[model samples]
Target: MSQVRVQPTADAIRAGARAIRRRNVEIVNAAGLGHIGGDLSAADILATLYLGVLNVDPDQPDDPERDRYIQSKGHASGVLYTTLAAAGFIPDSLLDTYMADGSPLNGHPDRNKVPGVETNTGPLGHGLPVAVGTAIAAKLDASPRRTYVLCGDGELQEGSNWEAIMAAGHRGLDNLVAIIDRNGLQQGARTEATNALDPLDAKFAAFGWAVRTVDGHDIDELLATFRAAPFERGRPSCVIAHTRKGRGVSFIEDRVEWHHKVPSAEQTAQAIEELSE
Candidate 1:
């Protein structure tokens, strides 16, 4: 099958991003709970991947040679689900069932039920290894498909990601790209107050990754970064997306308390209004 040419215009990309954030907010508001902070933080990156970069078809989600997208920071499943729905990977109505009993859309992403989700990830640091394995398989099969994993900055505290990093570099898996959502804040508090990953870019470089740091909310920057593939001939690439938790909403941005806080009805309305502006 020929790869679908992704000539995502800036307006379309922005629309996708808005749709993701709006849907995420709606889901969390309906469920009366969710990791909205992280969800909002990663919305732009998710939009860039699903709508701008990935060669995936919502109609043929199981195509073997299609690019893979894994959400390593699964707690933000709200964002992933909304992104999938916005990108047509799943019915938009299913978002209403989020966190409901027996619904496939749970608090954490499940690969079994979600068509576009590449792996079941709720535990931190699991996505990189899965992505690395997928990248290796693509290489072995001589397929041009690439693997992209979105990992949270706090999730990097887990040692497994480092191991995966080493393996990807050692095997020269240039098909793999890891995008870190560096929103600074974690569940309990700021990442710096807990475990600092200040030298994150250098760490990836030391592990032999070609690193690119960009503002996660900028559509132009994200599009450019995603398109500039294979920064190094024999090395996997890592994009440190510096983002703010609760990015689009002013009151919530960078607020650690919003990590798992469900916005009140009034706050939700305000947030939606703010995003629409």
Candidate 2:
């Protein structure tokens, strides 16, 4: 059965976001490879979900009735791993082994190796389709579980996501909630410079989704938006979380080059200090 969604205080959510950012820096510094930009941008969203929105038990991650969360922007797996550790799914010590040889914590999350991870995802545009399938299954089983997927705005250029979007809206999978990390910047440059997803809200609305836009980093807004999923009676829900790339770190914030760039010792120190504040 679906657990009740916890409405967290702003202070609590901000604290969680800080912890995730601090740990994310540490993880990337230790691993020497990560999608740091996206990781930072998506940290708050991940924090809000694991800390308050998702109905998941670390000890019972595979429970059939538990709410499902899929990270569509899997390149930013560091954020996901850090959030899982924060939520007690695994020891914080495991974070030290991230991206190391023989470590289960690879660049992309592996469901078989990581507790609380719903699936293995790294390629763009894959998570939403899988989430749609799972949502459909839950509906067929008459389960109370809700499916949540987090995708990057740049990844929306993929055809697969649109196909899944069409299918989800057509099938009226109200149990599904898709959150887009609309950080604007992709790996190379602004998403609009590469492949424009302008009128993103209208695009999804036309697909028969109940669309809503929110400050992705705002904990209070995230909690409220997620708590009110399936915004319409018979259509799927889509949340366009407007976020800044490399959020919370002054040097990296909104810089496209920082996408997978590793921070130097000085940069890492500064990032830690800023997030700690």
Candidate 3:
């Protein structure tokens, strides 16, 4: 413990999430590079996990029994770094070096440098497979600790994820929970036009996962849905969190161009103000 501890309720998680968004805008504005849209969309989910749900303790990051979290949508690292800072895994000051030449805060997370990250993740479709392995290890050890992975809707196009999905389902990795930040837009266009994943829930169900759909931005709903995991016994869980890219900021919300765009000084201020409320 650096300072942060798991918050007791959904309201506390929501408040921390707002702070995360405010700091995330600043982090991107200062660093001059970031996947702002996806970062904003996943802020609530990350915050809820780091601050309210995951069994990770900042001081005991490598505790064998601690829950594992992998950011499969690794491009949105600004939010991940900010959430880690808020969770006390890293000092808030370390965030100032994000994306800098010698910084550990790279464009994507590296477990070697980051205390809470379970593994290196940047390439799409790789994390869930790694998470499936971790969950399998836990099963072998008979540990109660869970494995969670957050993925991007766009990356679902990769065949590797499907393979991992099939393996987890077939092995009955009920300890695994995969959350897709289903914000619709991906990079320059919408996921539907690019590679439709609309029947995502049915796909997961068919893959043998207990599926649940929730408003990704609704903190209370997300918290409740996550807590009620593995909707069925002996099955993996898939949470399709429908969200808008650039969720909290009015001008940036759902704008595809903002996917990797840096906010101007004025826009950053406006975003911070909006998040403050």
Candidates in order, TM-scores: namely 0.98, 0.97, 0.97
Worst 10 residues of 2 by lDDT: 1-10
Best by lDDT: 2
The global C-alpha lDDT for each of the candidates, from Candidate 1 onward, is 0.91, 0.94, 0.91
Output the worst ten-in-a-row residue range by lDDT, candidate 3: 1-10
Candidate 1 structure quality by residue, lDDT tens digits, 1-277 = 4556658797898988887898788889999879999999999999988888898988888899899998999999999999898888899999999999999998988879989888899999998899999999999999999999999999999999999999998998899999999999999888888998989999889888999999999999998988897888889999999999999999899999999999888998999988887
TM-score of 3: 0.97
Model 3 C-alpha lDDT per residue in residues 24-102, reported as the tens digit of each score: 9998999999999999999999988787778888889988988999999888899999999998899999999989998
Steric clashes per prediction: 0, 0, 0
Please give the range of 10 consecutive residues that has the lowest summed lDDT in model 1: 1-10
lDDT of 2: 0.94
Better of 2 and 3 by lDDT: 2
